[model samples]
Target: MKYDTIIIGAGMSGLAAGVRLAYYEKKVCILERHTTIGGLNSFYRLRDRNYDVGLHAVTNYAAPGTRTGPMAKLLKQLRLRWDDFDLSPQVCSSVVFPGHKIEFANNHGEFIEAVCAEFPQQADGFRKLVKHIEEFDELDLSQEAVSGRKVLGEFLSDRLLIDMLFCPLMFYGSAIPNDMDFSQFVIMYKSIFVQGFARPFAGVRQILRTLTRHYKQLGGELKLRQGVQEILTKNGKAVGVRLDDGTEIEADNVLSSAGIVETHRLCGTSLPTPEPAYGELSFNEVIFVLDRQPQDIGHNETIVFYNNTEDFIYAPPEAPIDTRSGIICSPNNFKYVDSQQLEEGFIRITALANPQYWMSIPDEEYYPAKQHWCDQMAAAAVEHIPDFRPHIVDTDIFTPRTIKKYTGHLNGAVYGAPHKILDGTTGVENLFICGTDQGFLGIVGSMLSGITIANNHLLR
Candidate 1:
């Protein structure tokens, strides 16, 4: 039977979109190339320990019954409850630069107070910037691109404070190098500083499982390990898809979370615009299992975005990994309800990586390279937080190569194309894009991208 929609990539957006369509009583099938779901945020086991692929924290946090913000909107649209996500708000996180540091929690007031206290001279300007963000409609799809850096300059005169504010937001969501669209800046600002960070006790696995289960219950067909090799198009319309094994299925519409450049290649259809340039930035994720909780080692921050110098260079590094700056996170540091905790102590550090260098490294030297950089990464991190190196027992490293292999992202661009297709429209009549390239970010934003695309384009 012909399906009402065939969604590609069982990542957050694809699964969410499938659920949205199926809930409307449409016939939907979600196909994944990987053996499991959660393309970029899946989980795995190593030496009897669990590891999450891309989750640092679920941004845009909200309480159990809030009726506003992205968190509440997501649950309301998906017909889910807050307990479904099981998010615990972060304890506190900080952005540390040499001779300067500011801390913030879920409370936006604390962040404002910290900024004002830290940069007394820029307090008034900073408040004005906050007002600008509050008034901006970041979710407007038809908005033209505007440089965040330039817009920030119009509000504040302090370069350090501007870079500091941009640090965490860019690290978590920016696809562009050393810059972002103004709308993206507002969205990231509100999500991280205004709404804040949180995580489920079970990491990414819990969220993925929740989405998959809901989709299935709504009569959405999910086929894992069923990779789509190509888009079957007819007269500028998406007819269906051809599986990697050469099986063909027909559908009335197709939605892809596989990213813009990748999807363009798959479509093989004549389009109105040239294929967009994919992003260059990627990361080296270093996970260290410690012998004790991070708090025991005197490190209590949930996540620390540290830059060794004041410049905060945001680009692909010339070296294997950029040790000058990185993020250090301890999952055990979140304010979990009932004082519950994970079974193991974990410290994660993420550094900007040279994607070309990591992807082209000799296989024989890859493992050794990971170890060598892991040491450097930790060395840089210890300067910001207490040295927990002595407590480390096991380490896991994943680079751009691993990302490309799993998600099929061009250059393993974690945030997909630098330019976002906000309207989810491709040149093909019924084929659209979602996920990273669709412009929303993180777990909440990615899921919201799918839902928005489905509601605006598919359902209507």
Candidate 2:
């Protein structure tokens, strides 16, 4: 196929690039290895139930300004709207540590007040911290050098407060709170708390469907099951790509959302080898989706239970969220459910796994062990919600291997690269990287990274 731009990988980054290029009337072709669209945003089905394999919810979707947020603006630019979908308003995220529980609210003032209510001694420090985050202005997703740890450390002295506040956000960013750049942290905080957070009523896959529809509507050609084996470059320029089936497609420029390692492999001798970063091999959780919802679990937005910070901080240098001893739950709340299906309840329990540990397991033993891990996780969740075990009519578990096979990401990394404040920009010509790997995970950071890459390479 001959085109103006050839985009590799159908993930959000690749899709965003294709959408932008196509909207500008550029003949764009997106080649994806998967049979379906939405790389990490894709889902899997077990029986009649659908489970999200990658992304769950997004922040800043409910923000007041429609075209200001990254995803919202992209939809508008593509003449797409997600108004039809049912969206749940997440005003607070409840954090639980043994006997202690704190609710992080959406409103900045209210959030501070809530925190102060728990730890009154740290009230002044929390206020100053919020002030700093609110005052921060130079929020640029493009600039590679920004540390979140340094920014948070300035105002937060209590170690408990740091663990409570920065830990969850770090998981969302897929970067260590201490290592993250100040600017990125500011942008992330604004997107979540200042803007708003929301989840699609149907699930994450529905959002992907919406994006796919928009891409097709813009005259963008999508080639599914067409894996680009190599980037056919000649005379120091990206000419096109060679598919796995020996089919060669020519194009002016090749944009890869297949991740750093896969993109390098496809590029062959065209691009230099990308150096490994702290965030590349990070561990993500195996989300167990239960068929039945608990009856006693009271109304709560999202519950994060932390046993201790030791397992979280000392586990791996790059592990964003300590799932070994922690758990994040999306409980069954009447406010979040549709009126028709109120009886058919559902909930999600996520437990973080050690990537290295999973990697060490023998190939033949991997799948069975993964199932065992899911069982253990389900058991652990039952500890929190007693009625959870009986309500489970069906369950689905996804490991890093499943993520790697589906998305072509390195080590099944939930996000992409670790966002480092110091070495954010690696000198690669005509080649750019983004997504979780470039720092900033979750919906907001991923979309922001897409905007950064577009503004830097395309708009420039």
Candidate 3:
């Protein structure tokens, strides 16, 4: 069998690519290893409860009829209606240090005011920084790469304020957290702060469903529970793919949403052995099923970017899990529907962890390590959210190994292959790469990545 285009991985990027091509009436097929779609943004069921795995909160929000920002562009490009995503603005979120705390309101003015009030000495610098970010052209890859830390330093003298400003943005997007690229930092600031954060009424699965429905409506083929074993190439051009089941299917083009190294491996001898230079970061996430509403527990903040230590470190730690710096989100606080429809509210906590350490642990030590980290994180949460422990009705934990198994990301790299600008090329004609490895992060960014590759490579 042959297709006009064969897209590997049915993640956000692949799905968006499918929607774009199918919208153009191309015969496209999206292949996935998993039984379901959404990749890192996918969800799972736990007995009677349904938990969204990847999304703590959907960022980059744009209001209806406004049709601006990344989310607006995504919806407009995909021919999706504004009603497709029922988004509610976060009541409040914050970045907290030992002595200072900055609240982020959904409104741009309020957030700016909070920042200015907190750092009155650097208020002028902050305004100029935001102006620069607003004016920065995110698509201009020709712009040289500079360190995010360095850029912040140039504007603000306070290092902690820099870390505070970066806490949420970096966690959401940056792979090299300590020293993120200025381009990335600019894009993220615009996306998160300028555009703001909102929660989807039906959660992430709803967003996936919306994309899937649109693709199928456009007559695209979606193949789940099946994956490509190899890229069938001839004369240094990708002509087709062989399924894991030994079936050979041909295509004029192969667009891979798989990370760069993974896509390179599919190209046979054209590429060298995979040496992922971009240091990958993995995380340990635990979800707590709370018996009461977040507000009732004295946790009114919608999302909190926090750290126990005075300093911040973004890289994967080689030592035992610190649980020092991480994000805490209360889903119920932002749930769009009536609080009564939900039987219980939930709180999620995440911390950076060394994927290598988890991989090297003995089989006997696996559960022990997981338990140790789970307890450590729970204890750490009390420092930020005082009511974290008492409301816990049930708990679920996911480690690096779980991420690797579920997403097939190398070493459980959550954002995948770091931030290098690749031209979606593999020295193999008619083959391209997108998604995380393509330098776009977050749900909106990843979808845009697919649309980008489809428009630039497939359509052109």
Candidate 4:
């Protein structure tokens, strides 16, 4: 059957587009390769516990104005409300240095005040740095503020502030501070600072479920397990798609949320080969799903404990288990809690891994490699929090191959493309793109990209 719009890749962007189109009473079909929706917003279950594959949290939901933020307005328009969960009010992500740790807050004034209270000697420096960040926030991305890295260098002259403020934030972008454009960085920073970052009540899966429900409610058709092999084009415009099973679905227009390279491949002769910048891939992540919650962790706060910059240790290196950069969050306290209490509780820990290190292994050996990394990460977590090991009830690991097999993302990059200058542009006519690669990495970026793409294409 012919449809007004056929969206490829049911990630957040695709879903957002479907929602908008359906709202307009346009006939739309959302074709997803996977059996489920949400793409990186997807989740998996190990026994009774569920782990979010991606989408840790999002910011900018609380901002006023209907069109201020994409997710907020979308939810409101869909008649959905943010499910209240036990979340921490601490806007500041806790950063642990060798001898000291810093807790960042949401309010700019309060955050600056806290920093000054913690390190009085650095007050002046910190205040100046905050002002610089505020100024950076005001820069327009649509204009000359094209490069993130250059703008950061110009704003932050102090070495300590650069390391303390920019390093952790850069981790979220998955790139160095200077490598990102000023406008992109400001969008990310504002999402966290102004919008307020918070996790869902059930998990990220809840958000996906809500989006899917809304999509269906709008009379959109979703076909799962139907891998699209190529775009069926007549002349120079996209007309439809050919599925892996040799079936064809026709449409007036196509929107892709698949990774850049895959989208280009699907377009076939309809669109030119996307330049190299559009197809660059990154490493995959290794995630561990714990059976029993670890002890000596917070149920209210998200703890990112790093022993040596690479890993967050709950135990020593020689211990039976160790983790590199353990991220712990409790399903209980969805809101803020006392740091002392959060330092000691039942929790889950995830170790961030370097994908390149596992490249030498054979495809069949990927699972074992993931297991080895999980064990090491678990051991490390036990060192920092001794009671961590005895509680392990279940574990599952994901490799690069696993990511490619499931989502068709180049390397299991949770965020598809690097947020760089050249990567954001799409050279195709009446064709647009969004997702992690198009410069929007996290939930906020994904949602914002939906609005950005729509504004560029439909609205304009």
| Leading candidate by TM-score | 1
- Each prediction's total of clashing residue pairs, residues at least 3 apart in sequence or on different chains, is 0, 10, 0, 47
Shift of residue 326 alpha carbon in model 1, Å: 0.9
Q: Rate the local accuracy (lDDT) of all candidates.
A: 0.93, 0.62, 0.83, 0.57
Tens-digit lDDT string for candidate 1 (1-460): 6999999999999999998998999999999999899988889999999999988899999888998999999999999888988999999999998889999999999899999999999999999999989999999999999999999999899899999999999999999999999999999999999999999999999899999999999999999999999999888888999999999999999999999999998977566678789989899999999999999988889999989886989999999899988899989999898999888799999999999998899999999999999989999988888899998899999999999999999888899889999999998889999999999988889999999999999999
Mark the regions of model 2 whose C-alpha exceeds 4 Å error after superposition. 63-72, 82-86, 141-147, 176-178, 272-274, 278-291, 295-299, 309-311, 314-324, 331-343, 419-429
- Candidate 3 local accuracy as lDDT? 0.83
The model with the greater lDDT, 2 or 3, is 3
Which window of 10 residues has the lowest lDDT sum in candidate 3? 334-343
TM-score of each: 0.99, 0.87, 0.96, 0.81
If candidate 3 were superposed on the true structure by all CA atoms, what would the RMSD be? 1.7
TM-score, cand. 3 vs. native:
0.96
Q: Residue-wise lDDT of candidate 4 within 3-99, one digit each (tens)?
A: 8777777887777777777877879888888988778667876676567666445555453333555456656545556442223343335555445
lDDT of 1: 0.93
What are the C-alpha RMSDs, in order, of all predicted structures?
Answer: 0.8, 3.5, 1.7, 5.3
Better of 1 and 3 by TM-score: 1
By TM-score rank, best first, the candidates go 1, 3, 2, 4
Worst lDDT run of 10 residues, candidate 4, spans 311-320
lDDT, candidate 4, residue 385? 43
Q: Top lDDT: which candidate number?
A: 1
